[model samples]
Target: MPELPEVEGVVRDLRPIVEGKTIAQVALSETVFTSHDAGKQTIVKNNEPHQFERLIQQMTIIELKRRSKYIFFQLEKDGETFHLINHLGMTGAWFVVNDITEITEDKFRKHIHAVFTLTTGELLVFSDIRRFGELRFIKEIEEHPPLLKMAPEPFDEDACDFFITQSEKPKYRNKPIKEVIMDGQVISGCGNIYATESLFKMNIHPGRKTNRISRERKQQLFQVICDVLQESINSGGSTISDYRSINGGAGTMQHRLKMYGKKQCLTCDTTTKSIVIAGRTSTYCPKCQR
Candidate 1:
């Protein structure tokens, strides 16, 4: 799953290439999922795929923004403006190609579920091997259920306070700090990998109760979260598995991870340990993170 840093990196790489460009054509594989709204029950089916073409063909992309792990495209057609939201599920990736010929030569074509033909003769392709990704067209992004329900981005100034407040609440107070931070409603886009890394950096155990953390320690944890996320973005995000930049390149941050996948602590002689919290594998240094 792509987290804040990976999605942020995608937004940065896509803005320059897709902005100001008109959609010459839109091609979607039948296996690709499409929805008119954010609800799972509102899935488009049967001949509805053609409806996707009808709604999006020739629409111009004005801007691109990332909300949580979702990609938003500000689109225009005639005088009407709408939004396209993409959720890259598990194995999804976007790539730009010079032409359709490049698509055939590319190794990932078999999984290329969606392609946007640009006026510049370039092809923007989205490939998802597992087909868990989604493409949605919504008239108002703010009112869309998914976007509407998301908490503020982790980089938002109020996010730290929000985390602290949420931690003190009964719903989250007794939960493991790792699980608390991983809640998208508490803090968006802080996934398993980054949360583990951040907690390790703050010398906080992943299994610590959220309410057990002191105010000062919470402040440090908040800063560590921001620092780890920003550093991951700077390093192009971790590419532990399926994540890739728009240019089909792997992120370097995985190589720089301190505790997420480590067997031993770099700071101390203590061995690292793994446990499941919120159903995700968490790694931490037993001696360093307490």
Candidate 2:
């Protein structure tokens, strides 16, 4: 899945190219995206794929923003404003190209589901092999169910306080720290990979009970989480699998990983270990972390 850093990288790479540009044309596959709701499966945004193609035409992109792992595009049409929300689930990605002709030559086009042709003759394409991505044309992001439900961004001023408060909650107190941090409602954008790396840096065992952590250590953990996420964003995020920037560039953060997928500890000579926490594989240094 494309986590915070990866989504941040995509947002950074896209702002310059897409902002202020008018949508000249829109093309969408029959079933571009899918979602699950109360035991029922449906297309994203409760609209047919073609509806997205119609809603975005002639609209100018005002700004691009990210909340949690979701990307938002502020749009203006005839002086009216709206928003487009996108979630790059699993293998989803956005690719920028000079012309639509080049899309066929790019490997990402094999799964191309949506294409936005800009007035400048450039193209912004959304490709998702698994069809798990999300696309919604929303009038207000603040009221949207998904965006409204997300916790504060890691960079928010009250992030540490939020994490501590959420940790002390009865529902989370006995949960493993790794699982606690990975919960999007507690702290948005800390996925499995970043969660493992941050815990390793904080020298906190991934399996430690959330309530067992001291207030000082909680603050330290929060700081390390910010550090890990910012560093990954600086390195363009980890490309352990299909993640890539808008320019089709692979992220370099994967090479800088200390414990996420390593067999040896970066701080000591002891061998690393792996365990499943909250159904995700977590790798850490036994000696260094705890």
Candidate 3:
């Protein structure tokens, strides 16, 4: 899944390509409105395909923003402001091209599920092989439930304090440090890869109880999280398996990863270990991570 950095990079790149361009036509695959294809849910949510097309076809994109792992498209039509949201769950990717047949990447060209044809003669293509991603049109953001639980962005001023406060809650005291940071209510946009790397940097084990971590360490962890996310955004975000930029470029951050998928710690030369927390694998150096 594309985390904050990945989604942020995509949103940044998509702005110049898509913003201000009117969607002349909205094309959706049959797989979008149909039932699950091999356990996948309907990719286009919130309305039927024709209704979604009716609402979005002529809307002009004004701006694009990222929240956590989601993308928000600020749209306008006849002086009315509306919103469209996209969540790239696991395998989703976007591409901007003049012609889809000119696409060279197999995964991108073959799995395209939605195409937003712009009056600018460019097509904004959405492809998701796993079909876990979703696109929705809504009048207001508050209509979605998940956005309501999103905490402050990791780089926001009060995010660290919010993290500390959320950690102190009785229900979260016993939660693993890994799980705590990944909690949407505790901190936004810290996903499995970033959480694992941040823990490795802070020398805190993933399974360490949240209450056992000092407030100072939690503060430092928040800063490290910000740093990691910033570094990733700078590096164009990590491309572990399926993440790609709007132009089809893969991120180089994977080469800079320290602990996420290593067999040995580069710092201590200690053998690394793996554990599953919340069904995600966390790789850490036993000697390097406390």
Candidate 4:
């Protein structure tokens, strides 16, 4: 799955190409993006049939925002009327090109499922071999999922408070730290990759209970989570699997990983091991993370 860092990388690569441009065309294959919010999809297609056409030659993209893994485009046309929200679920990605290049099955091969053309003569493509990505139109941005209920981005006071509140919850107190972090309600956007890396950074056992976690350790965990996430973004995100930047480039962060997919610890050179927690694989160094 594309975690927050990987998604952030795509956002960075996309902003420059799609920011000031107008949508020229919108295309979708037979598969429809479905979830708890099924109604919005139709709303998007109906409300903007001409879609990128009007914007292609007229409007300008004012700003871009991300909530959890969803990316929202703030289109400015005299005032804030409507904006486009896109979610790249697992195996989904956006590709930008400078010309009307022919999209061969070889480009993304079978992964190319949707395409959007911009007025700047650039082609914005979406490829999701699994058909899990979604696009929606919104009059009010907060209707989106991550923006609607997710905790603040990383270090906001609201996010910090939310983190503390979740960590202290009685029912979750006995769960392993990785399980707690991966709990979307506790903090959105964390996945198996970050869950493992964050615990390893803070030297906390992945199996440690939330109740048993010390206040100092909690503070440390908070810092490490932010640090690790920011570092991943700076490094362009990990691309060990289907993840790729919007520019069709691979991320280099996987080279700096401490212990996610490796069998040996990068720090102490001990053999990395794993155990099952909350139905997900938990990897760590027994020597570094107690």
Q: Say which candidate scores most in lDDT.
A: 3
TM-score, candidate 1, is: 0.91
**For candidate 3, what's the RMSD?**
1.6
Tell me the spans in candidate 1 whose CA falls farther than 4 Å from its real position: 33-47, 100-107
Top candidate when judged by TM-score against the true structure: 3
What are the lDDT figures for the candidates, one per model?
0.83, 0.84, 0.88, 0.73
Q: In order, what is each prediction's RMSD in angstroms?
A: 3.2, 2.7, 1.6, 4.0
The sequence of per-residue lDDT tens digits that candidate 2 reaches over residues 107-131 is: 5677788888899888888887776
Model 3 Cα displacement at 70 (Å)? 1.2
TM-score of each: 0.91, 0.91, 0.96, 0.83
Model 4 ranges off by over 4 Å: 33-60, 76-80, 98-107, 142-146
Scored against the true structure, residue 66 in model 3 reaches a CA lDDT of: 91
How do the residues 1-290 of candidate 1 rate in per-residue lDDT, one tens digit apiece?
A: 88999999999998999999999998886554443333342222223666877888899999999988888899999989998888888777888898655644254677787788899989898887666777788788655665676778888888888888888899999999999888988888889889998998888999999888998898888889889999999999988676677857778999999888889998996888999998898998888888
Q: Which ten residues in a row have the lowest lDDT in candidate 3?
A: 32-41
Clashing pairs in 4: 22-55, 23-52, 105-109
Per-residue CA lDDT of candidate 4, range 174-208, in tens?
88888988877787678888889999888888998
Model 4 alpha-carbon miss at residue 110, Å:
2.5
Q: Judged by lDDT against the true structure, how good is candidate 3?
A: 0.88
lDDT of 3 by residue, 1-290 (tens): 78899999899888888888899999988766566344445778878777887789889999898987889999999999998999998889998999998667898788889999999889999998888888989998789888888899888898899999999999799989999899888999889999989999999999899999999999999999999999999999998887787868788888888888889988899999999987888888887777
